[model samples]
Target: MMTRYIAFLRAVNVGGRQVKMELLRALFEQAGFKQVKTYIQSGNVIFDAKGQEAALEAKIEQLLQQNLGFAVPVCIRSIAAVQAVLDNNPFPGVIPDKDFQIYIAFLQTLPGKEATAIIATLQSDIETYHLNGKEVYVLMKKNTGAPPFSNTYLEKKLKLVATTRNLATVQKVLSF
Candidate 1:
């Protein structure tokens, strides 16, 4: 039986690596994923799969390396997971305004206790964050400066691979 999934890729179209969406879609199709659709160049892909999520993630990562000539960490989440992240807004009191944007960092796995504690120490003058399972919700206070949150910082502090997506882009992927 096939299931729908959203795959978030790390290290694509950044640090001097560029991947075209058309090629990405083709590669995913070549990997046996059906209905392969890519969102923004930030490497968001929604596809249908028959394999387990882990197997799919590994297969996608392997394909990315062979097709792109580089290793890119891939995190796959169920369609329900995205809505759950939105529903479980850590900052329920924060007004949803144009100035503030919610970016979710999807971790490679649920963080360990020690890793969670380390992430708890992250200090930000312009943003607030919540670490829950494999999802970290970041509320950025826009006019202060660019959001200081990053996938690298989270991975470094928490010992996990992660990829982030803005709320807007995330919502759009559901429709695709």
Candidate 2:
């Protein structure tokens, strides 16, 4: 049976790499993915395919690199898995506003114990995070400058590839 999966791609439409949503959808469709749809320019693609998440991730990474001429790391999660992240609500009663925001970092793999220890050290008063399975819920308080932590920072500390999206973006992606 085909399973619905969301592929969160890293480094798309950022820096010098720009990928049109239509082109991304086309790549997935050419790779035999059905119902392929892209949510935003940040490279969130939802589709149906028959395979395990890890294998699918690897296949997509290869496909994108071969076609786009650049390595695109992929993090695949089942539709149900994405929904569970929202259902769990790591930051309870914290309404997102201009001053406060929530971001979910979708990880390529579950972090090891040592990595989790490092994550613990990265927390602070303005920035806090909760690691739930392969997902990290980050709560940030907007201050004078850029936030202390970002997707790239977490990836470096954890030594894993991950893509982060605003909570609202994830919600909208699910709606697709």
Candidate 3:
């Protein structure tokens, strides 16, 4: 049976690097995936495949490197798993558009003690982090782009591959 999966890709369309989302969907289809659909333009792809998770991830990564001409980190999560990540958000009570916004950065696994300790050190600066399984929930204040809250810093501190999107973007992606 084919299972639904979401591939969150890093560094797809950013920093003036233009990669069309349609091209991304086509790459997945060429890689033998079905029902391929891309959400927004931040490289959120949903499709169905049949195989072990590790093999699937390797296949997709290889396909990306060959087709996109660059190494793009891919995080594959089941549709159900993505839904659970959205549902289990710990900062629901906070105003969504006010001083609170959540971003779920998918990871391969929980960070080790050293990496996680480094990430914990930066938790007190206007950002709340909740590490749930292979996902990190970030609740940032009104201005996300300012101050110490950013995806680049968090990824560096945690030493893990990650891609982040606002809660609204996340919900839109899940709806597909």
Flag regions of model 2 displaced more than 4 Å. Answer: 146-148
Report the number of the highest-lDDT candidate. 2
CA displacement after TM-score superposition, residue 48 of candidate 3 (Å): 0.4
Deviation of model 2 at 5, angstroms:
0.7
Which candidate number maximizes TM-score?
2
Between candidates 2 and 3, the TM-score winner: 2
lDDT order, best first, reads: 2, 1, 3
State the C-alpha lDDT per candidate.
0.83, 0.91, 0.81
Model 1 residue 19 CA deviation in Å:
0.5
Q: Model 3 scores what on Cα lDDT?
A: 0.81
Positional deviation of residue 173's Cα in model 3 after best superposition, in angstroms: 0.9
What lDDT does candidate 1 reach at residue 165?
85
Model 3 lDDT-worst window of ten: 142-151
Better of 2 and 3 by lDDT: 2
Residue by residue across 1-176, what tens digits does model 3's lDDT show? 99999888887788775789889888899888999999988889999999866678788889988887888888888889889988998887875776667777787556776765665676766777888778888887766567735778778778887777777887888898
Q: Which portions of model 3 show Cα errors greater than 4 Å?
A: none
